[model samples]
Target: MEKVKESEAIEIDIPLETSLKKKLQQTPRWETFEPFALSRVPYIIRENNKELYEPKVVSIGPYHRGKESLRAMEEHKPRCLIDFLGRNPEIQIEVYVEEVKKLEARARRCYCETINLNTNEFVEMLLLDGCFILDLFFKVRAREPHTLLDVGWGAKTIIADLLLLENQIPFFVVEKLHAIVTHYEGDRDSLLYLLQPSSVSPDLPAKGNIYHLLHLYYQWFVPGRTSKQRSRRYSGILISTEHSRSNPIVSWLNSRSSRSNKKPYKPMRAIPCATELREAGVIFKRKESPSDVFDITFENGVMEIPMLPIDSIRRIIYMNFAAFERSNSAMEHDLMSYVALMDSLINSNRDVIILQQCGIINNMLLNEEELAVFFNQLGDWSTLDSDKHYFAWLFAEVELYCDSRWHKYRAKLMRDYFNNPWSALSVIAAVILLIFAAVQAVYSMYPYVHH
Candidate 1:
């Protein structure tokens, strides 16, 4: 009656392997196909620059495809797809669908987001996006006037949307469609021609390689920037803790070249902008290099910035590139770092003018203040990476030159005595006249001595 004791009952403990087996048997969602290549802009980035991150005109990829605002462009997609298909009257659209079906899994894996689409739906999406992109490149490379080109802002909007990071199909999908449709291996060349059209002939990947459109662009913009993989997919947001915590660009100027880790970083005053540097006798020169556009350098009292062709798409592409870096844990924010460097150089309208006169800034925007604000507001930067010296060294050298009393005095002397071309000529004429007067006075003294 003390009750059939509970101790008499049998205890059944579940085996750990059995639990694991159950978990293993559970249905896997798009997880089995998680891709390391493409991802939407992480919210932290998208939150601050939503306008830039969102597609304004067209959406080529799944990320921004269904937005209400982008609906108008969706109507154009069928037209683009039709034009792309019409180029080869013999090839049915099913041939393109089968090709995309083959790439569907690979393309799906390239996107970090779980594309909740059936194989048929996914393949169709890829084909439509891929054909639209190829059609755009074809129109750009055609060199003949199409009615679309004549349509105001038609060509411009297409070009801009193609550069948006969110608006990209997998490159392999695009390339395969290009080959099947165009009947040649000219996809890469056509894209390079359309994007650069002048100097760049990017050594694009062989068929199966490139990640997406932005990846294609960074390769052209920096030529070898993505030549090597910088981090594993596991690394997560490659920007350093210090960079996010404090503006390292500002920290480096404030820092006193710490030789040891134990030393506390001392913050120095921010370096002067283009105008201030000029007033302190610093020279601004355009660096002509086929290397990275942001390969800024300082030497012999001159700050040489590579000439950046200020174009409409440059801002859009750069914003996407920086966002891509922010989303990936393995990649460094080199694009963001570059923007911070530009921001440091431009503090006001006057600074933009300084760069413009020096041929460093091609102000296609024509509004110096607006351009200055654009650079200033790029990516919510507080400073730059203190440990990294993408431009820290240049800033330090500039700071040293500006701090020199001798440089300041000489700068003042040059400005006061010989600033303009006319001023220099007048000074030379005055010196020659004074020398003649001195000679005449000496001759008069000699004649008096002879008498």
Candidate 2:
């Protein structure tokens, strides 16, 4: 990482190539580029560190069944991918590789991984440069396209939505993919039918699926509409240390001492999930299945799980979990060493608010405040001004972003009110009446003067 000055904010260059940056720059800007906030978050940059893991194409065959060769490939795929992503400076890449491996592994177990990608880094990338991607999809759609509509906020659904929004393709995500073709294929009377079976010649490649169509509709038709309609379900996981599940932001809430003369961990009694913390409120929920498990959904959207202790959260976020697990729970890889470097960052930070994109929302069963503070005091460096600036920029950026969105919605409402026919018609009628009365008086006066 380039040394950044602590006193002044710096515009960190995108880890992406200059060409990619230029391409994205041409897209429309919704608001002023938040330079200060953007500067604080480390941009994506590839690393040459041999200590970092490299991603490999794991044989997804076990996911496909009857795949022995795939099992061997899978054995090495995750470790390689983690190492590759760890070396990169971009946090998104690190998060992505970790998730992909996890999903693939879960697939091997004959059960689907329940994680949703809508709230993940990939979705964040789409928000950043959706238009550019949409344009590319339009070109592809003109030739041939197959749309994929996802009913829920699943990973594949998100990926499908990303493709559609970036391109002007026709696609839909009904409750079920098969039902759309079987039930609504040819019925024009069906509002859904006009979208389905194309009256266009069978000769022409069928205009793509609902997924692509929806993306184009959102991008071109419903401008400013959400590309991915957020699902109501929470889509993140809570992480904590292994030994003690105490989160740094909740130091005051989860003290060993009792809150209401209630003995600690009273049987059959649930703890208060929401409470006032040092400078903010901490919210949490108890896990029904696991007595020790508690879900903390942060106000910023980062969810903290009490199942793991705070130290674990500190290690997992910075260091790849696979590396740590492989080392017999020892911090052997450079990623863990980097986690050590982040200890100062983790410690100095009094309040940590992880934005929803950080995968804190993966735990679905909680209200908003469980995740206010993540792990605290992993490292010792409160001295470096850069870290302070980094967090300051982050919080400020999020606040400004939210405020701008509110202002935009407010303006839209005002415009709609003024544009209503009844309001416009009343003003026009009043003006017309005044003009007519003035004309009549002028004509009457002219006639009298002539007589």
Candidate 3:
């Protein structure tokens, strides 16, 4: 209907390597649990450097969540869009729009508009200023939308797949449940959705089309769609929009599962491999949960894997090409120490390891601060599979190690002060002797003290 003049689209095509393809392959064994891997079967072995274009990659270190989040909002201009949508409620948007408005008004809103998809021209303004939108989808009162379209940079597909499974699609709200599509530009973490109001008749003629959605992805979602080879490519296979205009909306009278026909893809589950990079020894289980780095359990004295060492794998864990080239040894050391500690705990037998400035030797002796640090860093550890749990634990461990080392260093200074009390007495005696000597010298010179 209406287009934001500021937006420009870029297409990216990521060619999957042979190894990456195999890595993405679905092992028929656990297909029921992880289905997205199967649906991605179509593009399993894509070409390398598949052309991709979108907003630049955004970085939010675990330490700087609040400040980075606020900065992202200010840079992304969510407030302007929220205000715009609020005033023009009749403008016809996707379900996501309503969520944004509610959150923008909240003091502590969780959900937010992460990027402005419609406003391409203004995208640069937002990006250059270093702002972002908070994900405010939680405020909306709707069944999470099943289908999702992701148009962001760098491994965003992971987040997108997770969202879809969570039953939350990113869409703007034109009306209470009506989603409108203005213009088609390339996808870049920006999105628009056609809404389906529950109160509306299910038998209505204007439901959305699965094929049209597919075409939209081929057209706008993929980064570099144009460069694909004819025989090797999946371009221009669908009927043109002109052909489908006779009935722009398909009926959802009998709604099907978004993943109805497609099966889930599974990689090998809990395939442990021994890694000996340093004193850091890991029995990494490759195919566990997507979020997990290892897949071993720990209960009582029965650990699924042996504990790893922190000092052993410091080099690889701390080596970030960018940071390394820049010669940030301090940061490198911190990161290395942090990762090592995490690696150790992931394989440890302790069920509740408290990460503190004092390296946790005994899980039984953890204090509140140590527990809080561990829990806070590994926010939902209990819910994770062993792989994720261990990975999180390892990361948290490194941070704790650094803290513990600092604490120990400070403690040593205190211990030294208390250990040698005689040193303080010696200093006092010297001061008293100096005062007496000064008085005697004054008396001898002036003869007032002798009288």
Candidate 4:
């Protein structure tokens, strides 16, 4: 190529290899990539709920991995790497680096960002982050709590930190590291079980590819039972996102509503609080061995619902789960829908009090008002059309159960007539006296007619 200099024309030769490499790597700025592993919470959602979106204590991936505040935890990464390598002394340090180097391209493609990191930097990050996670899991599984992990806000903070969307490494990298550590089949299966102590091991998402720990956690709770659409009644509204697939930013709502051939939806309504329904003679019972936390049923006069725990940890988990689901255009916002349903039922402290009495809400936070507010505010994190929500049918059923004329009348009877012994006795005496008076009148009328 020839270029004109300030004084004269200059001729320079470009290398074919370098030129080809530059051309091959060049991508259109407008072209967006589909998320293969992880993504940042969309600004639309994160802006409103910043605390819910950001990690507080520990950072995992390259995004938040190297902050001044997070440096305290960063020191543990090398120590973990050393410990992990010590376990498998036969495998050299260079081997792990090479293995991760092979995965560096695929991993770079996983994140939504265009990583500025070269191959060496990215591989180093993966190795360090992956080792920290592996060591943490190994220590937890072995019941050998590391001194740092057991100190103030240690384990609890790490659990929350690991579940952060931005703080995730590729599951494949973790699996590869795990395999390198444990060579035998029986031993390897145990580690997998240890990784998800809270969930059924058999169901962990293929070699299952997950976006991150939060995604994996969301999948962990999916019911093993094959029961689909448990409620016969669906209310509030039936809908799905009506968007053309060609658009990259497709709405997360279901597209079933667009199919003209599909059957029309039945009417459904939101349910009342536990106390209001109880007044209507509806009994609330805790579900036994239910597959899903949101699994609820209204049959005859009984409303059986699984208990939901309300606390800081649960709220954090749920918020991340909803964010993760919302980030992926293909997945449904099941967590958001469930939280919305609960939030709708709780208007104030009274509603929370009622649910607590019925064993409907664990109320672990021990503050009814706070729990209700937490659930209510969760809707702001992400929005899902109520009609297309997963629990629409359950809401309709509860509304139907509460609206029963017979139940309302029975509730009134219980409240007014059989409220207490004194009320019952007063009614009984009034009826007896009225009967006697009627008999006396009848006798008098009979004598007059006979005369």
Candidate 5:
């Protein structure tokens, strides 16, 4: 009986060992996973407005590929591929297919999630999507419109869908297809120029390491500062150790002590709204023909902010840009920081009115209340490090100006006594009457003293 039991145990152990070995071989190496620039919208941001992050007109990537509502656009994709091939009669469809097939592995790594499709399916998707995108650009360049695509709201929504974070393929795939079709090296800037809306200035330089379409759009709009520029523009005051340089250890110790003695970092809070700032003597002006929308400046009690156009399409793009910044660690939070600053500046309709009056906000679609709510919600969705944002210096300067008692008193005096022409005239009249009364009293007293 003992010998029979030992044989059965050995038999069971063999299958178990084999199964364990197979599982280990199948397991992915987590450390080998690179950071993915294209990812789904984070739950924290999407919880409030999931629809905003999702593509409404079309699905460009695997994440939202087969939904029933998005199937209508899928049908048009094949037509786009045919149109693209028509333009490049020299190249065959198989050539495009084989080219995208070669890039399947590289393209898969760009997405955050593991795409469940096999090689054939993945390559087909890339080929169709890539050709579709290039076709749109070609048509736009020629000033011709697709019979189905450029009609009604379809064109606008398609542009919005292309900017969605999850709807992006690796930019290299598009560049590869463009190069093959045109038989010339693809200029990324030229390709990106076709994607921009008529409202966005196409002349802006699109220079950067672009991961996808959304990234290219971000680079055009929010060009980040270089390392040296950031270091110089940093709002924090640096401690000089010139005197302690004689002893290395002493310098190190002194630096350490100074750091330890410094106050703990406090998260940056929102600045006062536009109305409140106006009440505090901070002038608001629209920065005329600003080089960049984010180029806001505060000096001599005047705050010059670039005019921001508020509309449904722009709002969608800004939200996606903020979402991209939130998801990707490599991206600077320039857009998010801008949104936060706008949110802080516009707390209510009154705040919106103040900015609107100064030409800082070009209200196109949303009402004052809706715009206020939009910015407030946007600010809530974004996260910022107080000391590291692009606007940290601007925030500090504005707060410093607002904090001064003289500015507040001056503003209060102006507001309370001289807010309007009538009020100024009343103040002047009251002063004149008081002076006359003083003169009359003095004359009366003078006559009595003489007596």
Candidate 6:
């Protein structure tokens, strides 16, 4: 029998093809799609320390709105609402609800995930959460005591929860609710004033530009230098891609020769730890009244770093800030850069002690080892671009200072001979004895010559 001819190849499924085409057409274009400001902490970062990302006591946004563990704080939200409403008695509850309802779509778009709550539910959630936050701010500003917020550890936990990457509603929602409730006519004073501490200027980003509470908090720590200035500073260091790739052998040879010829003043992948740097004659000092925590500087063998107080709550706050920067590419990695710098400087307990003695670190951890571990682990959460980060110049200067051979010799001499008064005295005595012996030998030679 003739080999059975295979049935004609199956024709493409017209309906299925059409369906797929429709799906492809509906899919968002990656080039044009903007990222949501509020998103889950990336798994790469969250896996390192899940507790830092999760809200322990309260949930503000739709992501963690109904969790069983966070529900205990839900009942307290209504109490906050009552307190908020009591602040502005003339404005009815419906006015606030209506305002938030208008903001529902915009607020939902701020979150990366699709919100499951309906219009009514979403509006009410926004109302309660926004009012709760504003009430806390009011309480904090007035220095008034709240039954829950004033209770032991409650304020700290709630503040951390509010700053969580997952637990945030859009700031505009809160701002709108505030305006409706308070009828404040001032341009900058109402919400911005309340959110920031007295020390931070209320002159923040324009109202429409702010994403959420965490974003606002992130803005407060931004380095005084503008991005344009940073770009200018890094402009000279950028090698032309065409020139680098023009000749492989020549490029390799040039790189080798450059390495051999230079004094190694380049940026380091990881700078020496505090102890090692100290041994290299690098002095550490606490930057007094720094503009912000990121204001670190190095000059003439001295590194002035702002004081960093490490505690459980502050660690969580900073970690969340780092996580936010990691997730949102639009944000500058100021906090992450700072963390990376700290991680490089603190490699062990001895390094911690060095920073502590210089008043650079006020570690509240059980031991110096724990603080060191915290920084080391945090460094793993985000990869820093040393050449492009805020601390790039500072790092380069520090490495250049450490690379000085004279500084090393001087440091060695001080450590070996002048480390203590006894050592210094012995050194002085030995030098004097050698000088006397040389003088006596010269006199004896003179007598022989005269004879």
For each candidate, give its TM-score against the true structure: 0.72, 0.17, 0.20, 0.78, 0.83, 0.84
Preferred candidate (TM-score higher): 2 or 4 = 4
Q: Write the per-residue lDDT of candidate 5 for residues 145-202, one digit (tens) a residue.
A: 7875658887778888899988888888998898888776756656666666555565
- Candidate 2, residue 26: Cα displacement in angstroms equals 3.5
Q: Which residue pairs show collisions in model 5?
A: none
Clashes of each: 10, 50, 55, 5, 0, 0
lDDT of 1 by residue, 15-83 (tens): 678878888786455566645557676677578778776777778878886889878777877888888
lDDT of each: 0.68, 0.29, 0.27, 0.70, 0.77, 0.76
**Candidate 1 total steric clashes:** 10
Between candidates 1 and 5, which one is better according to lDDT?
5
- The candidate 5 region of ten consecutive residues with least summed lDDT is 239-248
Model 3 stretches astray by more than 4 angstroms: 1-184, 187-414, 418-451
Q: What is the lDDT of residue 450 in candidate 3?
A: 57
Ranking the candidates on TM-score from highest down gives: 6, 5, 4, 1, 3, 2
lDDT of 1 at 348: 87
Segments in model 1 whose C-alpha atoms lie over 4 Å from true places? 1-37, 44-49, 144-147, 183-196, 199-209, 224-270, 288-292, 311-313, 381-384, 420-451
Per-residue C-alpha lDDT of model 3 across residues 1-451, encoded as one tens digit per residue:
1233323221123444855777657332332331111021112211221111111222221111234423543443454345334534665434444433442212111122222233432222222221121222211222332222122332233222222211112221112122222233333122333222222232232223221112222222111212222221012223222222222112110122134553332211122211111112222221322211222232221224323222211111112111221222222122222233343344322322322222322233234334334323322111222212112222222222333345455445444543477865776788899999999888788867456
Q: How does residue 428 of candidate 2 score in lDDT?
A: 79
Candidate 5 residues lying further than 4 Å off, grouped into runs, are 1-24, 30-35, 196-203, 227-267, 435-451
Q: After superposition, how far is residue 183 of candidate 3 from its true place, in Å?
A: 5.2
How many clashing residue pairs are found in candidate 3?
55
Residue-level lDDT of model 4, residues 1-451, one tens digit each, is 2345622432235567877888777852333443464888777867877777677777888888668878887787888889889888998999889878888877777787777887888899999988888888888888885966888778877888888777888777776777777764334455557577553446443244465666666777644223343324233333222211222111211232245353433434356766677788877777864346756666677878787766777677777776677777676667776777777778788878877887878887758878877877666657665555666545545655675698899888888998899999998999999999999999989978999
lDDT of 3 at 116: 26
Q: Relative to the unseen true structure, what is the C-alpha lDDT of residue 334 in candidate 6, on a scale of 0 to 100?
A: 67
What's the lDDT of the predicted structure labeled candidate 2? 0.29
Which stretches of model 6 miss by more than 4 angstroms?
A: 1-35, 198-208, 227-260, 263-266, 449-451
Q: Which candidate is the best by TM-score?
A: 6
Candidate 1: clashing pairs of residues:
236-329, 237-328, 237-329, 247-383, 247-384, 248-384, 248-386, 249-384, 254-267, 254-268
